[model samples]
Target: MLWVDKYRPRQLDELHCHPGVTDLLRKLMDTRDFPHMMLYGPPGAGKKTRISAFLRGVYGQGAEKMKVSTRSFKIPPSNSTTVECQVLDSPYHIEVSPADVGTGSRDTAIVQILVKETASALQPAMGDKHVSFKVVVINEVDRLSHQAQAALRRTMEKYVGACRIIMTANNFAKVLPPIRSRCLCIRVPSPTNQEIREVMHQIAVNENITVPDDLVDRIIAASGRDLRRALLMLETAKIKHYPFKANQKPPLVAWEEFLEKEICDTIMKNQTPKGVIAVRSKYYDLMGCMIPADVILKTLVKMLLKKVSGDTLKSKIVTFAASFEHTMRLGAKEIFHLEAFTANVMSAIKQANTSQQQGGRAPSPSGGS
Candidate 1:
């Protein structure tokens, strides 16, 4: 197993970071009956870990026994087509992401089907008598369409008796206000740099490996406060070389390196329609490989910010990037938005150059107004 999963916390108290959030979860578990929960945070911030620990506290060891199955459900109205959805099932809970069932109205149908199927049934009599309701975990709740989210809201209200819905989202702003109001929203912020360093040290001790302090600092800097990524970086570094060098840089995954070299470099050097077209092809290549459009746009913006010198140019690039990113989320064709963002950045750079060039031109010899 990878170090990220191997070092994962099995119980709430076992969790090293986010002590306040752990305390709140412990209190909720103590009540034995808590409201629906919405856990929102950046990636690798222990949202899923907390959920697992909370369930285990309520359902005991049975909650950890998990199995994966692909279940098919018929779409509503016509009831003619069936979509297959992968679900992770435990004796105590069922987890599914509606976005995984494919896009459009089908996601709404899957959300309705899964929630109704799981929530309408009463909890089976297991060894634990105090546990009366099962859990329905919906991952990537923010990606659900408006219709799907609306369906989820209705099901959540109707099935409050037999089950509880726990949702995880990277961005809570995308979730509808009505749904947000129904659940007890919990924000799990990313771990601090100190917290990440401590975890790295603990993992090193457990593995009996000597990780130099400088290498640990490098990993933490590259991880962006994501503990999971930090752990993965450490393991990858260890695998490459056992006795680590203090100056050894942590390796970036292939896609990140590719973006930096191929995409970002191309954008900086070429700022024209031809440049936009060339970048568009590369964008297609990346998307064809299953890299998400948002990840691509985000990395491109970050890299470009570092390359560009002036604050004004960087701010303009960020503004345009944010606008296009929001558009990408709402629109179907990601390539269009990605290309548009590239063009906008190129345009900004060109304008800045024009202003600089015109300002640099000396006054005419006649000095006439």
Candidate 2:
């Protein structure tokens, strides 16, 4: 088993980070019935972990006994075509995401149909008494179209008596305001470097492995504040070499290295039309590797931020990256936006260099240009 799964917290108290969030969750459970929740945070920040722990707290051991099943639902009105959605089912809750159904109008139908069916079903009795409602966990709720989100909002209101909806999303802004108003929104921030270091040491002790302090620092830095990635990097390091060297670099995922060396370096060295075309080909190569367009754009921006010097240039790069990313999300073709962002970066770099060169040749304020 992978270390990430093996060491996952089974209960709320077992969670390593987010102690304040843990305390709040425990207080909610004390109520016996709590409001619907939306847990939003960056990837690998333990949103899913907290959701699972919360479920376990509510349903006992039965919540952990999960099964995966694919079910098809017929579209309304015509009732001709069908959409298949995969769900993780436990005794007390069902988890599904609209993205699993695909992009477009179908998501609206899937959201309405799946939640209606699950919520309408009768809840099974636990040991002594009947559980009043089931929980529907909608993963990545932010990815749903506005129409789909509207349908979800209605479903939440209609089925308030039958089930609770717990959603997980990376960006809170993408979720509709109506949906936000109905649920108790919780933001799970990424772990700090100190918190990450402490967790790594604990895991190392449990595994009976010795990790050097410097090696741990390198892993933490490379991890981008993602704890899951940090743990995976540590495990990979162990497999690659034991009793590690002091100067050994932690392994970065291939895509990150490619973005830094092949793409970012190329942009910095040659900011020309020809350079943009060359980088476009590399973007396709990354897409071929199944890396998401947003991820590629995000990583490229992060790398370029480090290489580019002035504050003004950095701010401009970030603005354009955000605009392009938002466009990518709304539109169908990712390649166009990806190329656009690359070209924009190249132009910015060229302009910055030209300004610097002119500044170097220009006379001081006391003299002439």
Candidate 3:
């Protein structure tokens, strides 16, 4: 499949992020001082990508061995491994096997097997004098049970040789306090539109996909700061023409058609920007192809350029965009956040006009750019 997985970013530099995180990961790699880490972030972000790269860099072939220390290699894959993490009780060597969750009915059976087997099997590894950390990497940490977590905690403490446990989850509070307390938490934030745009352009060239210049914003907008999702969306956009890949390939989705069905009607008539923003909020997550809040802002910027005089909307848009970027960075709520953003654009233009009209300085409040 081109989507959901195939377009995953494989390199550290390719990660959609600010420079600060890249710097931290580099330092951790240099010193091998990574503590048991918990990575929390929104969906489709680069949490998994960075985690994989960090581990690969640190533990790759011919990688440096830790000094005067012991380590337990724990890599959680969907398949079983021969790794020593579950060597004793798990003859197959994967703590949680797919069979456990493969069927709807057997989930608890799988969890129990993992908790019992992993807890006991790890005790001997803790005995190694040079071992300093029994590192366990659990994916979907939230899915683990209260019982599973209880058993897991003992291993962390009893295995004093272990440095820590690193788990990834979309929600942080679901983790037990004992587990959370033992490690430092890190948040992997979403990618920005600019970051997503670079990845999209690269994807278009690599895959020979076509997207309109304006719809380039649509692609970036749809991905919601997720690099993997963005690239995968590009790939999927091509595949949606599948069966037709040999003939009658479809044009990339247009900017307007890609907007919400409701927003489309309002915006085409050049309705109030406040009214457009108000309506888009209703179906924000429709069918995985609808535009995002940030993208809505961009689309409106395009509209302002077309609708207003001297394109006075340009300077106002540039300013509003900066504020919206920060608002998203702070994890603002979408409906209220977007409403405020659209409302401000309308108000700011009014202020600029007021300053212009009253003795060359007067104002009027209007929607959008």
**Residue ranges of candidate 2 with Cα displaced over 4 Å:** 127-130, 272-274, 326-333, 354-369
Evaluated against the true structure, the overall lDDT of model 2 is 0.85
Question: Candidate 2, TM-score vs. the true structure?
Answer: 0.88
Order of candidate numbers by TM-score, starting with the best: 2, 1, 3
Summing lDDT over every window of 10 consecutive residues in candidate 2, give the lowest-scoring window.
Answer: 360-369
Badly placed stretches (over 4 Å) of model 1 are 127-129, 269-281, 326-369
Count of steric clashes across candidates, in order: 0, 0, 21
Q: Of the candidates numbered 1 and 2, which has the greater TM-score value?
A: 2
Model 3 vs. true fold: TM: 0.49
Output the lDDT of residue 240, model 2: 83
The lDDT leader among the candidates is 1
Write one digit per residue (lDDT tens) for candidate 3, span 76-127.
3443432222211112122222222332323333433344444455443222
Backbone-clash count (model 3): 21
Candidate 1 TM-score to native: 0.87
lDDT tens digits by residue: candidate 2, 8-68: 8999989889899999999987676788899999998999999998888887888889999
lDDT of each: 0.86, 0.85, 0.53
Per-prediction TM-score = 0.87, 0.88, 0.49
Error of 1 at 131 (Å): 0.9
**Candidate 1 accuracy as lDDT:** 0.86
